[model samples]
Target: MILKTYRWSFVVTALGLVLAAWYGLSAHLGIGQAIALVLILSILEISLSFDNAVVNATILERMSDFWRKIFLSVGIIIAVFGMRLVFPIVLVSVTAGLGPIEVIRLALEGGDPETPGTYGYELHEAHPTIASFGGMFLLMLFLNFIFGEKEHHWLGPIERALEKVGKLDYVQVIVAGAVLLVVAETFATEHGRTVLASGLAGIVTYLLVNGLGELFNVEDHVEHEDPATTSAGTTASGVNGPSGAARATGKAAFFLFLYLEVLDASFSFDGVIGAFAITSDPVIIAIGLGVGAMYIRSMTVHLVEEGTLAQYPYLENGALWAIGALAVILLLSIEVEIPEVVTGLIGLAFIVASLISSIRYNRAHPEEAHVEQHHAAQPG
Candidate 1:
C-alpha cells in the first residue's frame, strides 16, 4: 500500500513533462529544452534531497494521518514557493532593487540579451557578496550540525532558573526572538545583508509555519492509531498494549523530518543561485525543481512506511551529518566559490552511502520490520 502511494509521485512527474511539452509546442518555447530542463532539475533536486527523505521519514513517521497529508500538501507549497520562488527574489529585491515579478520575468526569459552588466535578472555586475554570504551561511550550518547541541529536555540548572521566571515555552520564545533580532540586525550591513537575511528568513519562516501547525493542531496522530496492515493487539510481556518506547521513537522521527526541511533550504541556497547560471525562467526552474521536489516528498513517505530508519540506525546518523555539512556549505556559498554541482554530489554521496548501508543492515537485521509491525499494531 505504501509503495503504491509513492509511485504516484513518479507518475506525476511524467505527466507534468507531457503537459509542459504540449504547452511549449503550442508556443515559441522549445519543447525539447523545457523537457530536458525539467528532467535534469527534477533529478538534481531529488539527489540533493536524499538527506531530506531520510530526515522527513523520521518526522512523518510520528505524525497522525491527517497531519501527514498536510505535510505532503502544505509542506510542498512551502518548499516550492518559499524556497525556490520567494527566497531568491527576496535576495534580488533587497540587494538590487529589482521588482519581484520583474526579476522572475528575467529568470523566465533567461536574462536580458541586451543588458550590460546583468545576466537575465541575475546581476553579473554586482560584487560577489551573494556567494560570500552563501559560503558563510553554509559554514555556520556545518558547524551547528557538527558541534551544536542535539535535542535536550532537562537543561538541569538552567531549566530550573528559567522555570522560576516563566514556563519553558516563554524561555524558548525569548531565546528564539533574540536570535531573530540579532540576525535581522546583522543584515543591516551592506555587504552581507542578503546572506544574513536568508538565514533570518529561514528561521522566521520555520517559526511561523511551525507555530501555525502547532497552534492549529496540525500534527500527525500516529500516536493514536496504527496503519491497517499492522495488528493492534497483544504485547511481548502480555501487557495488552504497544510499547511506549516505539511510539516515542516514531514521534522523534517526525520532528526529525521537520528539521530536515529546514536543513534542505540551507543546502538549496547554492543550487538556486547556481541555477541562474543555467537559465532564469521561473517556469522552467519551477518545472524542473518542482518535479524533483515531488519525488523527494514521495521518497520521504516510503522511507517511513518501509521502516528503513529503524532498520538502519546509521542512516539517521548519516543524514544528520549530511544536513549539518550542507548547512555549512550553504553558509560558505554566500561568500565562497564552491560549485553547486559539487554541493549536490557531496550530499548525494552521503545519502547514498547511508542508503547502501541501510540496505545491507536490513539484510542482516531482518527482524527490524517485525519490531516496526509490533509497534504499529500497538497504535501510534
Candidate 2:
C-alpha cells in the first residue's frame, strides 16, 4: 500500500539521488565531499521541513487523487526552482541592483575573498525582509488553525480556549498586525520599514491566496450534496466527486494547491538563506535541498496514505504549533543570528513531543474511532 500510494515519490527520490551525485561531481568537491554535503543538506531540508510535511498531509488528504498527483508533480518543481534557485537570485537582484546572471555567478563562485562581498552576504543581509514576510505569513497560518474549531485537540485547554475566543474572528488578524509592527520596530532604523512592509506583504499575501481558495471551494459553497454521494461527499463507488460526476472540477482543490505552493515558498525563504551557511555552492544547495524536497513530498504522501494525522490528532496541532514557534524564531533572528541547527532542533523537539503525546493519547483512547462513529450516527 505504501509503495503504490507513494510510487511517484519514490521515483522523485531516486532522481534526486542521481542528480545530487552528478551535481556534486561537477562541482569538483571530490565525490566524497560532494556526496557528504548533499546528504547533509538533504538532511537539513528534511529536518527543517517535517512540520511542513505534516501540514501538507493534512491539506492533501482532503483533496482528490488527481489534485494529489498535481501536487506531487508541479508542486515539487515550484519548490525546487522557485524556492531554491530563482527566489534567492531575484531577491539579490532586487536588493543589490545586480543582474540575474551576475547574481547567479556570484552565488556559484561564492564570496570575493578580498572585497568581503558575496552572494551569501547579500542574501544574508536581506534576511530581515525574508524573515519578515515568511514569518508573518506563517504566523497567520498557525494562528488561524489554532483559532478555528476542529475535531481533534492535542492541547485541549489552550486550543479550546483559543477557539472560544476565536468568536471574534478578527482577533488573530489584529494580533498578527500588532506583532508584525513590534517585530519591525525591533529592527534598526534602516531595516525597520522594510521589515514592516515585508511582514505586511506576508500577511496580505496569505489573506489574498487563502481567500481565493475559499472563494472557489465547491464543498465550502455547496448548498446541498447530491444524494448519489450519500452525505460523505463521495460517490457510490467511493471516489470524492461531489455531484456524482466522473471528475470534480476541483477548483477549490486547485486554488488550495496554489496556496500550498506559496506556503512552500514561504518556508523555503529561510532555508535558502540558511543554506549559504552550509555551503555557498548554488549547485550543492539546489541539489541537496532538492533531494530533501523530494523526500518531503514523499513523506507528505506517506502520512496521508497511512492516515497518520487521523491516527494521532495531536500531530497536526504540534506541527502548527511548531510553525508558530518557527515564525517567532524567524522574526527574532532578524535582530540576532540564530544558527540553522537551532531552528531545526526546535522544530524536531516539537515534533517528538507531539509524537509522544499522541502515543499516550492513543493508548488512553483506543476507542477514539468508536467515539467518532457515535457522533456520526447522530443526526444534525
Candidate 3:
C-alpha cells in the first residue's frame, strides 16, 4: 500500500535529481554540490509542508475522484513550474519594474544575495508584500477553522472556548481585520498602505473562494433523511444519486480545488524566498522544491485514501494550529527576521504532539477506534 501510494513521488524524485545534476554540471557548481543542494532544498520543503499535506488531505477527501486526479496532475504542474519557478520571476519583474526577459537574465546571472540588482536581492525586497498577503490568507484559514464548529477537538479548552466565541457572527472576520490593522499600523508602518492593501486582498480572496464553495455546495440544502438512504447516495430529502451529500461535485468541487491551490500558493511564499539562503540558482531551487511538492501531493492522496484524518481525528486540528503559527511567523517576519528552521520546527512540533495525543485517544477509546476504522474502510 505504501509503495503504491508513493510510487509517483519516487519517480518525481529520480527525475528531479537527474535534472539537478544536469543543471549543476552545466553551471559553475559541480554535479555533487548541485545534487546536495537539491536534496537539502527538497527536505526543507517537505519539512515545512507536512502540515500542508494534512490540511490538503482534509479537503481532498471531500472532493470527487476526478477533481482529485486533476489536483495530482494539473495541480502539480502549477505548483512546480508556476509557483516554484515562474511565480518568483514574475514577482521580481513586477517589484523591480523590469521586464520578464530581463528578470530571467538577472536570475541566470546570479550574484550575492546581499548585493543590489541581483535576483535574490530584488526578491528579498518584495518579501514584505509577500508576507502580508500570504500571512493574511493563512491567518484567515486558521481563524475560520478554529472559530467554526467541529465534532472533535484537540487542545480542547482553547478550541472549545474559540468555538463558543465563534457563536457570534463574523467573529473570524473581525479578528482578522483587527490583526491586519495592528500589523499595518505598527510593524509595516513604512509600507503601511501597501501592506494594508495586500492584506485586504488576501482576505477578499479567501472570502471569494470559500464563499463560492459554500454557495455551490448542495449538501447544506439536503434535508435530514434516513441514514441508509443517505449512505446509498439517495436522500429521502429528494437529493438524488451520488451527489446527494457524499462529496463535492460540479462548481462546488472547482472552488474547493481553487481554494486548495491558493492555500498551496500561500504556503509556498516563504519556501520560495527562503530557498535563496541555500542557493541562488533558480534551476536548482525549482528542481528541488518541485520534487518536494510532488511528494506532498502524494502524501495528501495517501492520507485521503487511507482515511488518515478519520483515523487520527486531531490531526486536522493540529495542522490548523500549525498554520496559525506559520501565519503569525510570516507576519512577524515583516519586522523581525525569523529563521526558516524556526518556522519548520514550530510546525513539526505541533504535528508530533498531535500524533501522540491521537495515539492516546485511540488507546482509551478502543470502540471509537473500531468505528473510525470501519468508516475508513468504506468507500467515499
Q: What TM-score does each of the candidates earn? A: 0.67, 0.87, 0.93
Worst 10 residues of 1 by lDDT: 234-243
What candidate 2 gets wrong by more than 4 Å, as runs, is 5-10, 112-115, 187-190, 219-249, 369-380
Local error of candidate 1 at 35, Å? 0.9
Give the per-residue lDDT of model 3 (tens digit) for 217-324. 676532333343222221111112332236676887788788889999999988998899999989899999999999999999999888787788788888888999
* Candidate 1 lDDT tens digits, 35-57: 88777777777767677677667
Cα TM-score of candidate 1: 0.67
- Candidate 2 lDDT by residue in tens digits, 270-375: 7787787778888778878987888888898887666566566578788888999999989988888888889888888888889899888878887984443343
Model 1, total clashes? 42
Q: Which RMSD values do the candidates have, in order?
A: 8.3, 5.3, 4.2
Ranking of predictions according to lDDT: 3, 2, 1
Cα-lDDT of candidate 1:
0.55
